[model samples]
Target chain A: MNEILADIERWRSAGQRIAVARIVDIEGSGPRDPGAAMAVNNLGEVAGSVSGGCVEGAVVLEALELLEGQRDAGITSFGFSDDEAFSVGLTCGGTIHLFIEELNW
Target chain B: MSSIYESYRDALQAEEPVVLATVIEGKNVGSKLLVFGNENIEGSLGSSELDRVVSRDALGMLEAGTSEVRHYGVDGEARQDDLSVFIETHSRSPQMIIFGAVDFTRALAAQSKLLGFRVTVCDAREVFVTRRRFPMADELVVDWPDRLLERIGGDLGQRDAVCVLTHDAKFDVPALLSSLATSVGYLGAMGSRLTHEKRVDRLRSEGVTEEQLSRIMSPLGLDIGGRTPEETAVSIVAEIIAIRTGRAAPRLSETTGHIH
Candidate 1:
């Protein structure tokens, strides 16, 4: 979050409604730890990352849906689990739980 | 309407220590609170008693720089799970104090910044310790290592690191002694076998105990056979990572290990 603060500020100043996705938990061999964050603006502009390139595309999709009011702000999980809720999975075989929410607060 | 967010943003922008506590579960879902130092909390957990207890616990967690989900009774009583509060602390960056300001110091400072450390490049020689020389460093302190450490030693913690790149005994001896006095987790001194041997003898003469000497990584960095400053910095950072994880620095393919 600290790393992306400048970019977030730039985007916010430009009047971009942004969604922030923070890694709340991880299971198995995660490339990044909990608290890793990625910010996505309504324009699809992105800053920072929650994973090692994996699941970021899905996160962008989620952020866009959130901005569109198609989904509520909450946790999104991605991994190689058999549940198959998310098509994109981490190559490292780790499960990451991300809390996706608008930057309203 | 913007006061809470503004305060949070300002604190984050200034790199001040703060924590955002959110009611993630139970009755007051989405309720928010802000905790900073020992000040009165800005928001509530739907109850005065819950706010008081959670604020106290949040301060302790902020000091340790930890984020976790804590369970408590509706009114903050223990041994109850009526509510779950996620206390996410926004701590100031862990410090990396490099006591050398040499060529290696430049690379190390750059690498430390990449790792999200607030790097301070310190050396007694004002000529070498200029900010222009190590622009990547967060601070350039032209002072003796011992003097600087004496002032800030109390703040040093397990997450912090102290690198003594001054191979010269004149600067390194005092630097090592001062670093040893602090609780800094990684105390690395850059040197070779002979230089480390001589340094050990000098440290002993200065009343540094064997236990304290063992804590210092005399021949700093892993045995990666790195010759250049940048490569050496990578090796040193890798060593720090390995030390923090308590893993034997070895090639993964060569050994059967848990692969943490």
Candidate 2:
């Protein structure tokens, strides 16, 4: 989050809506620890990263969906361990739980 | 009046400790509360009782410099999964204090900053400790390493590091003695095997116990065969990470199990 603050402020001051996705939990061999964050603006620009390249593209999509009101703010899990057939999985075989929501607060 | 995020941004920019608690599960998702180091709070978790309890726990997490998801009842009761709050702490960054303002100190300071450490370069010679020499260091102290440690030793903890790059006995002896008294997790000295043996004898003569002496990672850094300052810095920080993670400093291709 500290790394992306500058971009977040720039986008926010420009009157662009933004969504934030934060890794709430990780299991097994996770590349990044919990509290890792990524922010995506309405324009699809991104800041920071929740995973080591893996799952970040999917996280951006989730953030965009949240911004579009396509889903409520909630926890989304991505990993091969899940039975939900998550196409995007971490190469390190780690399950990451991300909480996606708008940056209104 | 500032919003919760404004307060959080200001606190973070000022390097003041703060924690932001957000509800990720249960009622009122996205509700946030900014818990400052002074116990002051802004915003709410939709319930005053819940806010009170979460604020208390957030303070504890802030002290530990950790972030994680916690479960609680609607009113913040323990052992209840009615609500899940993500407590993200922004503590003061960990510190790396180098006792020699030499070429290695410059490289080490830059490398430590890359690893998110607040680097401080200290030396007894005012000529050696200068901002021009070490622009990456967060602080430059022109004083004996022992004297500087005496003022800040109590604040050192398991996440902090102290490296005595000054190979001279007059400088490194007092530095090692004072560093031994601190709780710093990584206490290393840069030297060869012969120098370390001599230094160990000096420390023992000064009444440092075998156990206390064991804490020092003399002949510092991994066996990376690095001789240059830049390469030595990489080896040193890698050793620090290996120490913190309790890894044996083996190459991933040669080892099994988790690579993280």
Candidate 3:
């Protein structure tokens, strides 16, 4: 989140709606631990990353859906443990639980 | 309108220690409590009692520079799992105070930065401890080791480190001695095995307790066959990590065959 603050602020200044995907939990050998986060704007721009490139693409889709109003902000799971829910899985075979939410705190 | 994100971003950008405790599972999932060091809190976790307990725990986790998900009851009871709060800490980075401006210092400083440590290079000799010599160091102090520590020792805590790389007794003794006076997490000295043996005797003469002497990882760094300064820097950081994580620094080659 710290690394992406500049980008987030820039997008906000441009009046872009933003969604945040934060890793709330991880099981087994995860590349990034809990608290890892990524942000996606309505334009599909991304900042930060929640995984080692494996899950960011999927996270971007989730963020876009949340922004599109087609999906509600809530918990989203990815990685091998929840492969049924997500087509993508962490290459390291760990499960990561993320909370997708609008930056409307 | 002001929001918890505004305060959290402000505190983080100021490099102040802060914790963002968020409810990720259960009622009011996504509710947040922004916790500061002095028990100053903003936002809520849907219940004041839950906010109180979570803020207290968040401050503790912030001090330790760790983030994790913890379970609690609706009102923050210990034995229930009705809610999961992701207590994410944005503590100030750990500090690495290097007490030499040698070739190894530059490498070690860069390595420490890679591990998210705020690096400080200190040496009494102004000629070597230059900003040009160690451009990556967050601080370059040209002062006596003891005096420098005197100004900053109280701020050192469990996540801080002190590395005395001055092999000379004149500088090494005061460096390691002053380091012992602090609660820095890792204390190490760089030298050969024989050199550290002589240092141990000198330290004993200075009345350093056996327990304090034992805390020093002399002949610093893991036995990773590191020959170059860069490789040695890796070994030293690896040793610091192993010590911090309470793990044995065993070479993977040596850990086979079920010797344990």
Instruction: Indicate which candidate wins on lDDT.
Output: 2
Clashing pairs in 3: none
All models: lDDT? 0.86, 0.92, 0.90
| Residues B1-260 of candidate 2: C-alpha lDDT, one tens digit per residue | 98887888889889999999999999999999999999999999988999999999999998788899999999989999999999999988999999988889999999999999999999989999988999888999999888999899999988899999999888999999999999999999998899999999999999999999999998999989899999999999999999988999988999898787
Q: Pick the TM-score winner.
A: 2
Interface RMSD of each: 2.3, 1.0, 5.2
Q: What are the runs in model 2 whose C-alpha is more than 4 Å off?
A: A81-86
Ranking of candidates on DockQ, top first: 2, 3, 1
- Number of clashing pairs per prediction, in order: 0, 0, 0
Candidate 1 residue pairs in backbone clash: none
Give the per-residue lDDT of model 2 (tens digit) for A1-105. Answer: 888899999999999999989998988889888789899999999999988887889888888888898999999998753436656888778888999999887
lDDT of model 1 at residue A10? 92
- After superposition of all CA atoms, the RMSD between model 2 and the true structure is 2.1
Off by over 4 Å in 3: A81-86, B250-260
Residue-level lDDT of model 1, residues A1-105, one tens digit each, is: 778888888987899999988887778878877677899999999999988787899999999999999998777899873435545888777788887888877
lDDT of 3 by residue, A80-102 (tens): 73546656887667788998999
Across all candidates, what is each one's fraction of true contacts kept? 0.14, 0.72, 0.61
lDDT of 3 by residue, B130-248 (tens): 88989999999999999999999988988889998989999999989989999999999999999999999999999999999999998999998998989999999999998987779
